[model samples]
Target: MRKASIRLKTALLASLTCVTVHAWGMSFERQERCIEGLTPKCQVMILATGQIDKDSPKQFKSFAQTFPRGTWVAVSSPGGNLVGGMQLGLAIRELGFNTTIGNSDYSPPDCLSACAYAFAGGVSRKLTPGSRYGLHQFRGSDQAINAEDTQKISATLAKYLDAMGVDRRLLDYAQMTTSDKVTVLTLAQAQLLKVDTAGQTSYARWKVEVTPDSKLLAINSSLFTVGSQIPITLGILPVPGQNNKVACLIYYKSNDASAFSASNPQHFEIGKEIYPLISAGNWQEKTGGYQATFLIPDNLLIALLQAPDDTVITLSGSFSKPPQSNTTTASTNPLTAYFGVGNLKNSLQALLKR
Candidate 1:
């Protein structure tokens, strides 16, 4: 029985290796059309079902040349040929085209390993909803690269990322993921690195819901709990002067000192007024503006959202004038909202029970 089991294990290992080796080659089918309903000015090129190869650059350049400048190239690949991938990426960058991970049908797709290199070359990159970008350490057929050559590759990649305006920290993330296992970037990670550069309009059309007000606050979820954090993304108009700061103030009347004690900063001050920053520990600065996660428990949040109508949250700071003449009255306040007492009470009551 032991001898039979050993033979089965060896056979299965050989079969798995064969499958992996077969996936390490490249082929592609290119489709030219406006994908994702983009305009003709932004023609879309699709690279689906293939690995990158020595001729990949030539193939990409040929199609890219036919399109006007600033086209979008949608890529979906299992990854192949590291050298070829980099070359193809350089060519795409040279042509000044944007890149996304998607299919000709506008379906989401994966850009993994070698494919990630080419995707990074975009003048403006995007990863559509349901799409993913994955990475892993560099590798060769023998599963090892010389130290000197590896250093050169690292330097070259750093240079490319710098030129492409991508965050260098991405290299750290890539290296952290071993070659045999893929590291798929989370939505937050992709956005933080500017890998998804789809415009504000595109994003607004997606999952974001903007308040119909002079000051807008976009909350990812209306539901909240003490156990986890919820992100509230604020869109602040550019300030009048450089380096101007905005402070978000949260006010609540609490009898429970324990809840209040848990906050990062016990107090927040702006001029003469002071209030505790809610869930201060969860606050962070993001690419465009500031985001804060509400760390207060359901009951505390309910209290803040209700009673003492005077208790309120506000954003106060100097902000740049909106460019549009019609929107000149855009609020410098950025965020000001009053939660409905009855509705919030019910929501919190149900949430805490769960």
Candidate 2:
């Protein structure tokens, strides 16, 4: 709808409809690597490289079945089949996987045109340093397509981007360039458009609210998990009728129905200290996922408040089980979601003044 010149090529549409033998499509390969972190552990990584076609999403789902949910998917593609690329992105997002623009060897690679759509699907998208994320106008195979059809395709693409938390302005950037050329975005621009989210741990800032009792105070912030960016709200509220006393809790809500399990071990980590969290015994099952709460120890809550503003607090839990394999010992690698204590002290001080 933006412009009559912006159109999808019938060739790409044919790729999705016809049952013809194309040269080659996307390939999904699995590899195991020792991930270095608080605990050095062996993790399975998926490498998706090649042209994204109609079959790519299916291929990815099949290949990803054996790996854990937070597994990394490194993609390197020149782009193909726009609809197929969006479908592949949806699959990635559905599985709660992380995406990056790279190859199996971890070399920076180009994720251009339609491939960018698939990249957008990542829960945590990272553009490798030196990697190129380019977009351009869609091209067809010399088939005449009407304006109405093109507008529909554009609208669908816009909706997909919005669902993925990407800026719709990305489409404007794509339309600005012709299909024959690519418009590669700089790191700053990519971050501005939310195509990349490296080092972005918190989704929401600290918000202070008055409890229903009026005398008690509640402060909450939304922190995201490391790989998938699963939102976990950290809430600190005064204990009822306990003067200068507060209780802490973490609330996890996800659209993925299986996102959290009561049996899984969950904890909060600050520096060398590990504080275990127990289920608050409150659970609500929603349409697609569940919402649950975990209670934080009073000591941990005090530590969090006293800690430096730049201190990073991790919310870890065994969210997924490892695949059964002889080469790798099956272990529950806890999800390492963390957030910095940015201006929390100031917010608390301001709240007290209020």
Candidate 3:
């Protein structure tokens, strides 16, 4: 019985090795498309498919030399070789190419496990509605991997993801999933995790609601922020006692010991105009963080509504140090929030029609 058990283990190991070798064999193909209208133009499209191996990066580098920067690379793979996938992703990024999950025929394709890492290298990563991006726990290629080696590998992966500007929670999700099972990400999940870097319009939308006083409240709670540790909410509503004017309300959260204060100078930069924002009141302590509100002028709110969908509105403020008893010196730190106006006009128009 002992001999039989040893034989079975050896056979299973051999089988796994064979499967890994076959899966690691990746291919690179170049496709061309041209417009034959009044002004003819041609472009090259790269189709990268199959599992990633140690040599995949070198192969891609050689193939990419013939194409120009900003070329589109469509990939379809079941994933293989974690390090190889990361290396391929670096190469793709270095070449300044865009990436999507699909085949040459435009059929729905899967970028799973290591393939997802490779896809992250794109200057602009795009995952269509029908495509799949999946993750799973990392598995040792050989049975001899020790815990120390595993830790090193995990640390390396974390570093790679950080460099790619992806949230580390993605790696946490992958680690929590079993190796035999895959965790597929939805479009919303991808956007929230910073996996979809293409700046899609679906990230934010405007919605309307009626207040208790029978007033129309047009709110866009999905405002995106940068250079800030807390999430911010933005809304537009009628100014109290003013019939023709509307005010923009901005809400943000901060920690109890945070340097943010109502006395800090705040302003909004809408297009080329800068407008001062008045603080609503004192900060209210909340479960996770302290909440504060600011109001934007009606003219600035009109400017925001008239701006293009791609316009980026800026909210700037300063964080001042707490007053000291013995010292008269104080320091101020600058903070800014940037959010795009996406689907705002159409959504507002649709809301008003109701």
Candidate 4:
């Protein structure tokens, strides 16, 4: 078989090997890899949904900083703030994270709008079988847009797809789509569109660290409870650090603080990956300041619902690196990243009502 598309020259990272995933439509599991026992070139940095602002270059910087030389980033979003997608994509491309697209750790995937735009940035991107990506007729609004605006979005997307070396046929189809035809690419289609670079990249050997004040920190928002499968973003940084490993850590807190559960609480870590197919534990420093994304699961909805409304998610984490904790993703444009938070919440409510 052909080697993966990753082009890193680092000595520590040799393409390990991929353990074939035979789970086909078995459970609709969103996370393609649990990563607990598996290894990768490095940990998959994640981004939160609807957090990045459109046309915001700062988002680009945020990702660039987290894993300056990371293997891949998992983008979880309902879509919004796509303007900065171009800049963010460029940043990912420049940083050598050109091997594969990132995947969510806890929740199932439903990437949309700007999230998909950023997804197109990987050197060699792919999606799980059930992954869903959406494209609307308008660039950023639910209101009616003129034909010219639609054309502009199309051209912009075309340029980006081309930059990622996407097949012309897929780009052609995407470019011509009208509002009447919202485009969504399934995982199977993503494979055909984005050439397979599966076993090519991992964050096994990047020069990362956990400083006392690393700029990028994990956003384990305090708005969710246990069993709540939430989609989040893992911001990567590239600044100097104590060790040549990935920064930050992800931890899940159960109702019983006395008990810690890896399967119950999903953590997405950042560090030099173990390539080919590495387990989540392959990297050192399983706890403490690290680049792991801790999210809330949906199964805990009942417990949360029993509590008062607007129950804030209880999350805690730390940052270690240069004291740039205030160092936001550098961007020239104002941003307003959007996600289906409202939609998701509504859906959850509707399910509750049912």
Candidate 5:
């Protein structure tokens, strides 16, 4: 049955019946077989189980060239080389194909470790019922890594997952498990981490923008329950056709009806950086466009939410730019991109009381 759309291909690659090469004494094989009975308007290509090595990407490329865009790539394998898996995964993403754990006969199979990584690169990915999906840390042959190398690898992996719209927390959870012991995620966990997108067509997102016509710097911050320490992302977009810079100093203070008080200072930490409720003179620079992210502190976050229902935090920030040479007013028009609560005051009140 069709879950998502895939383009029909004219040419098909033959499934490999024999070993094409060997790596570390293990024979490697790859196959591309077309699923019969599909309509001419759509197609499914099954990539048979085999070890992924340096040559895997080359083989994948040859098969992919024969197919049209949006083909569903059914992958099943025990997983092998990390480099090869990443390369093949990137190619799958670039080709805009979807991925599933199945074979030419439509039988589900094991897609573990590096194979899971390739599956993740699919524009849309799914794990069929009865199919086994496994994951673990990216490690070397020795199954050990230096602290420096670990940090670098984590940063790169997180970035890749974020770009793929997969939850970066999957990396964190994977780090807790060793390579020898695979972490098999349930379908619920997979859906939570954005690893499984079957039957899902849309997701809720939050964003805030300020235009020249409206410059209140009004932030539509998403309101969560008290003591919820979630990440907050703020973005700044420049007005078109001008040399301009926009900057913001965020301030979260408990406020009465009349004024805001910063006497009880607070701090929010995200990643390795801590941002004070009142920003330091070192402004967050905005060259073309700027984005800043931070995690709300549990204690301070409670204060912001648990306070009186009428209490509000006045967000203060500034934007500056040099005088424009041309008469265009584009420079003055800045947009602040952020998430807004449906009803800022009312929503927070309801959430905090909950």
Candidate 6:
């Protein structure tokens, strides 16, 4: 029986391995559109976890040619092709295309490794409900990369992420640490990382009730949780509609707390306030409720450890300035009418319970 069980486990793992390497297990409609004969649209629906190698070079080359004007290459990959994936990530910078992670159809979350790379490249990035981005340690079959190589990889990735406009701090999370491999970013973390976070808009995103007069002032988060990552979901009242576009400043709290002094604080932008900084990515229920996860940078974790239990999660919001000439005042989203921080949690708890 033990032998049989081992065989079963190995079989399952092998099956999953195959799925992970190739961009299989997805149901998507390929949309054919080109811009300036360079970038092309590769829209996809992520119904299951898998990799993407199909026409990757074509997609990469196209984006490199047409991306400066915001051409998008849609994708639905659980993530695969690390080297190719990294190359694709680099292409986003070279091609200059705004990336997209959701297909027109309702799809499962894009997750793990390579998919996360592509998701991060969204010019106007997004992490809708079903949308997900995952991370893991760098690994291979025979030989292993040394520490120096990993550092080189980190530096290269830093450049890639910088080009994507991700929080500079997130680069630390993107680095590979353990060979075991397993880093998934929940929706809450996605918000903290300032990945374009939209609830249920693109696929399976958190749904915020907004009214005709609703307006979200800003979004914020605490520092990334140490030891283990904590999921966080920052709120934005007037989320982008069908387009799923969002832009804002994401303050990455350094793991080194000394850099942030209370008397002469430099953490907050404009020195307005301070808070913890959590990683960002799409978070959904593994079984029930939301599950957010991201690598906790050592520095942010250190700061959080010293923080008090009641430490308010400092944050900020940047509402796009209204039309300069509009005479009308504004209203708020009824769904976002909560009074306190706990209120949002309570509401989410209630939502999860339901």
Q: Write the per-residue lDDT of candidate 3 for residues 1-354, one digit (tens) a residue.
A: 011121223322221211122453688888764422101245667889888776888899898887875687888888887767876877776555767776645333888888888887775677766788998877766775457755655666675666555767888878788777888999888878778765432224567778798877676542212322344566666657755555555555444344544466678787678988777776665554455556656677567669886575667666575321111223224555555576666544543442
lDDT of candidate 6 over 1-354, digit per residue (tens): 011121222222221220224345333333553223122333322122235453463455543442233445556665554545644554443333445555444445455665666566443455545655666655543455667655655555555555454655665555543535556677677767766533111111223454356643233333121111121234432224522222222332222232222222112111223433343443333321233223323343334334332233333322122111011213111111001132333333332232
TM-score of 6: 0.39
lDDT of 2 by residue, 1-354 (tens): 111111234343543321111335788887764433302245667878877787898888887876765577878887887777877887786566767776655334888888899998776777776789998877554564467756766776786676676888999988788777789999899999989865442223466666566643445433224333344566665555544444455554444433344455678788889988767664466443355555556687578669874466667767655211111223235656555576666555543343
Model 5, 31-125: lDDT tens digits are 44343322342444645466666577667766677665456777776667655565566666655566777743432376776677677777667
Candidate 1 stretches with Cα past 4 Å from truth are 1-21, 24-44, 104-108, 200-354
**lDDT string, candidate 1, 235-348, tens digits:** 212112422222232332112222333333433222234444344354333442234343343333434335442222322221132111111222221222212122333333
Candidate 6, residue 260: lDDT:
20
**Which regions in candidate 2 have their CA more than 4 angstroms from the true location?**
1-23, 31-45, 65-72, 90-97, 103-108, 123-126, 138-165, 178-181, 201-237, 243-296, 299-354
Quote the lDDT for 247 in model 6: 23
lDDT of each: 0.48, 0.63, 0.63, 0.37, 0.47, 0.39
TM-score of each: 0.47, 0.55, 0.48, 0.40, 0.48, 0.39
How does candidate 1 fare on TM-score?
0.47
* Highest lDDT model number: 2
User: What are the candidates' C-alpha RMSDs?
Assistant: 19.2, 9.5, 13.1, 21.3, 17.5, 19.8
Question: Taking the tens digit of each residue's C-alpha lDDT, what string does model 4 give over 1-354?
Answer: 000111111111121111111221111112233332225633545443333343334545554464544355555554444454444555555455543333445434655545566566665465544556655433333344457755555565565565455654565544455534447765556667663344332111112224377443322221111112211222223224433222223332212221222222232221221111112342222322122332233333333234332122222221121111111212111111111121223333332333
Query: Candidate 4: lDDT of 124?
Result: 45
Query: Which ten-residue region of model 4 has the weakest summed lDDT?
Result: 1-10
In terms of TM-score, the best-performing candidate is 2
Where's the lowest-lDDT run of ten residues in candidate 1?
222-231
Show how many residue pairs clash in every candidate, following the order shown: 3, 1, 0, 75, 3, 38
lDDT of 3: 0.63
Better of 2 and 5 by lDDT: 2
